[model samples]
Target: MGRRTPSAYEGKGYLQVKASNGKCLTVPYDNGPAPPAGTQLFWWDCETRWFCASQLWNVVPVQVGTADANRTAYRFVNHWTGLRLSLGPATAGESGGRVTQDTCPK
Candidate 1:
């Protein structure tokens, strides 16, 4: 078995989450579904992609598990909407939800 790393997206910076198909997570601006906040996040080919303001995420470290737990995790907050990136169910074909400014679940 492989031991997971203590921290992955910790600290302040941009987070580019790559899919199994080698596409990076992106906030689409052209011909994409417009969320209430205006932009939606999606996966795109990183090599030939163009720059957009929504692509930048503010990485913030949050305490993992209980407060007494020494482990650390992170939340990717959108620089535009200030909403923390959230994941949906692990089921297949779920394309995730809109970026909303909500508190990080404990």
Candidate 2:
């Protein structure tokens, strides 16, 4: 029998992210609808495709399919600004090996 899977957007979706300019960004993606309230977001790059939030912050590492219970130290970058907020010390996780092709910057 196949193994049961969990929802990808569970618990981590909808995070209220703040930018370097003190402008809060409303993330509504499947990974995160909006970042958690009061989460600090540092501008890693204005063109990179990913960001890293605080390490202690619990977030779902967004992947293609099969939602898992793996919490990593990285938050997917915002698509609009093309900047990702670093979450942890930048450790290599399972989803880190996977590659996602996007036409956007960062």
Candidate 3:
């Protein structure tokens, strides 16, 4: 779900999240719905020139059960794909990541 223009990714409020290892989170594919679930994710260098969808992530606050304390839990959703970052294919819920983009539960 990559856009032709970089309007959504430009200006303030957009951040390229990187890890301690110096690699930034990347989506790996650009074509709409091209990379199906189980597409291995990598922390590649961010595409600063054009600002790819895979480079930006949004930390969404989700509602969880009140087991002991009711606190907000967060899910990382890709700007373009609108998918969540899952642990891997085996447990891909909304289901994305280790980088599989599967439909997850509310």
Candidate 4:
């Protein structure tokens, strides 16, 4: 994965994260309006097109409550949906995950 700081961040500290495939990582528009939990993420052309704003993320360092605590873990916060990324398909693991989806809390 790679990231580009969109001009929109304007030194505000958000990142537009993308993959080697040249696609921006974003939530699915198919499940609109703002998909629910477990709605798997999707890849798009990074066009700044409608529904693509969810691709912007903030990298937050963890300072507490981890197995090792003290900056050992990080969280990626979605700009649009305001949800943290999550691993889905219950059976997924470190080897690989069937999907990475974000939960929408009501």
Give the candidate number with the greatest lDDT: 4
Per-candidate TM-scores read: 0.52, 0.21, 0.65, 0.74
What would the per-residue lDDT of candidate 3 be over residues 34-91, giving only the tens digit for each residue? 4655566777865656777777766677878788877789776777766766667465
* Regions more than 4 Å wrong, model 1: 1-12, 30-34, 37-40, 47-50, 89-106
Clash count, candidate 3: 9
TM-score top scorer = 4
Select the stronger candidate by TM-score from 3 and 4.
4
**Candidate achieving higher TM-score, 1 or 4:** 4
lDDT ranking, best first = 4, 3, 1, 2
Model with the higher lDDT, candidate 3 or 4 = 4
lDDT of 2 by residue, 1-106 (tens): 1111123323544243445554333322345444442234432222213332221123236434346654444454443333354433333264533222122223
Per-candidate Cα RMSD to the true structure, in Å, reads 7.3, 14.9, 6.6, 3.5
Candidate 3 collision pairs: 86-96, 87-98, 92-95, 94-102, 94-103, 94-104, 95-102, 96-100, 97-100
Alpha-carbon RMSD, candidate 2: 14.9
**lDDT of each residue in 32-98, candidate 4, tens digit only:** 5766667677677885633345777777776656576555566777877777778775746656564
How many clashing pairs per prediction, in order?
0, 20, 9, 0
Cα error of candidate 4 at position 37, Å: 1.9
